[model samples]
Target: MRNPLNLKAPAAALAASLALLAACQSTETKQETTATTVPAETSKTDSAAGPKFLSQPLVKDIYTADPSAHVFDGKIYIYPSHDIETGMPENDKGDHFAMNDYHILSMDSVGGPVTDHGVALAVKDIPWAGRQLWAPDAAFKNGTYYLYFPVKDKQDVFRIGVATSKTPAGPFKAEATPIAGSFSIDPAVFTDTDGKSYMYFGGLWGGQLQRWQKGTYDANAPEKEPSGDVPALSARVGQLSADMKHFDGPVQDVKILDEAGKPLLASDTKRRFFEGSWMHKYNGKYYFSYSTGDTHLLVYAVGDKPTGPFTYKGVIMEPVQGWTTHHSIIEVKGKWYIFYHDTQLSGKTWLRNIKVTELKRKADGSIETIVP
Candidate 1:
């Protein structure tokens, strides 16, 4: 069967699909605050490893795909849409945007070349996968891996689905039905220090943050839908119970931040524009980072808590020679780095490559950008 996100066929497509199905059906949480020190420079000299920072493409010749990376068992695992071919044919329309398969890549160090372990997840295996698989985000808790992905069913309706696996390089198993049931995509999972698990999703239509109860699917039960004062870009945070299933609190808007870590006036035009939200706590402060405009640039904000009166920091990075960039931030061995996709190779969106670079903090506690 043809994959959802349209791409030219490759010799190994069928084998890759089967492998993913076998791996996905298997899997199964907390947050803690730890002190992290900021390093002085972008590049660190190490006698054993040579250099502390490097950049390489994890997956090659795919379309503009978003990536989610996490460290598991001393390895870094990346889950991104499997957009195979360099570009889509002109006549292809509708649901044939690009076919997606989830693959597992790993390395011992942050700057190493990611070795592909073939396909880890695929659409055909899941009864409801339909054809398209959009963005897939994975999180490891309690010895199991949970992968939340967006899929289009046979009816061409888009929604999010969850798959489980025992290992990061998975054989994932699908749930009976989608968790949220909303026409949503790009699902990201986050767990807080209070043992609460939350899932964040949505794009130009705005974003939603829902709490997962100990073992249930009612993310919207606690909070009433906004009666009137909703921002154009939608982002809500709901509390999750310990088991990572169900909701505990009302879903509410994500706190906005100003440049000095203070609240900013909400702008209707700016709400729907921000994309790619990732949360991290550093030095006792919570940092919420996101993408703005055409995906070529990245900006962030900070607060004392996850539900924030966040203040914007500034743009961390922009397109050096590429048009748009999608990124994730990771800290390895006392240093910070940003992993993102860039369009420099093909320049037309497809054939974009994953790039990594050292992240530096300014004297004012802001981040510095790397020019291509």
Candidate 2:
């Protein structure tokens, strides 16, 4: 039977290419100078103090979620899944299944309000964008920006696509139609220290890893299937060409960890051992963070490499007030922080708000999440 998805290049080559492209773009642009500030430690005397962590609302009125932040030209540019609620109701397919527009929000500081830069990229602009445009991940390389995103056709089937722009906040143009093949969502692009690039996706179809080869869009090429069951969630890493359009090797599965830095097993009944894979390297070790269970508890693991033999680090943050969380981790100014979405302000699931908080690594190499 033929797989319904189209994929280009083996997993490794594709990752390498993305890294190169991001690096090249970084070199061409001036680095943003506005330093992201970490909040001072809360005083024990302040009994009424709210959660120690707080995130300034970036975009308002419009329901914006799944934010990815990148610094460009002295500003923090956020690319988020955009929806239209104020204008002519552009109903692509009924109200609930409407498509999205990728918009860029800029701020001078991490805690600053995100200013609207308008629509950075949109579905109608891409050739194969049938309707749904979800999860936009951006990387800069060689004076150009690569915005990778997941799109669905009129049928609501998902595929990945790449777009290029000269600036982070840009009029990005699609490079190709949904990258050949694949039915995946939550596309993440990463570039490693050795200049290798990788792309990871696959939550619903279990976890899959593919390498990108030059001049091809075959995600299965040089395929390396994951050793374990499709993690309730999983992430893959690989090397990419400097150009950011090709791959150099195979994609590998990353491991989940417990608080003591031990591996955690996914419950066979899908009770939430793993989901939502996010990665970052600090202090010579790579940290892989993910969500668990329907409650969306946060957990992490540490590894020597992007791909693991990782030691589980345990729960970083648990669902608050019965609210679930989806998050990403980033390091700024040598401090680690967690960026996650929650139902604090808007109880509606679709209206969940994004939050950021300082994360402290214990002497044991585990993280303590501060609630905001």
RMSD values for the candidates in order, in angstroms, are 10.8, 12.6
* Tens-digit per-residue lDDT, 85-152, candidate 2: 22233121223324356666666665655565555666778887787676577788888889888777
Per-prediction TM-score, please? 0.70, 0.69
Model 1 C-alpha lDDT per residue in residues 48-102, reported as the tens digit of each score: 4332224444444233356777778877777766554424542212133355566
Off by over 4 Å in 1: 1-54, 61-64, 86-97, 181-183, 205-231, 259-273, 320-323
Q: Give the candidate number with the greatest TM-score.
A: 1
CA lDDT, candidate 1, residue 110: 67
lDDT for every model? 0.56, 0.55
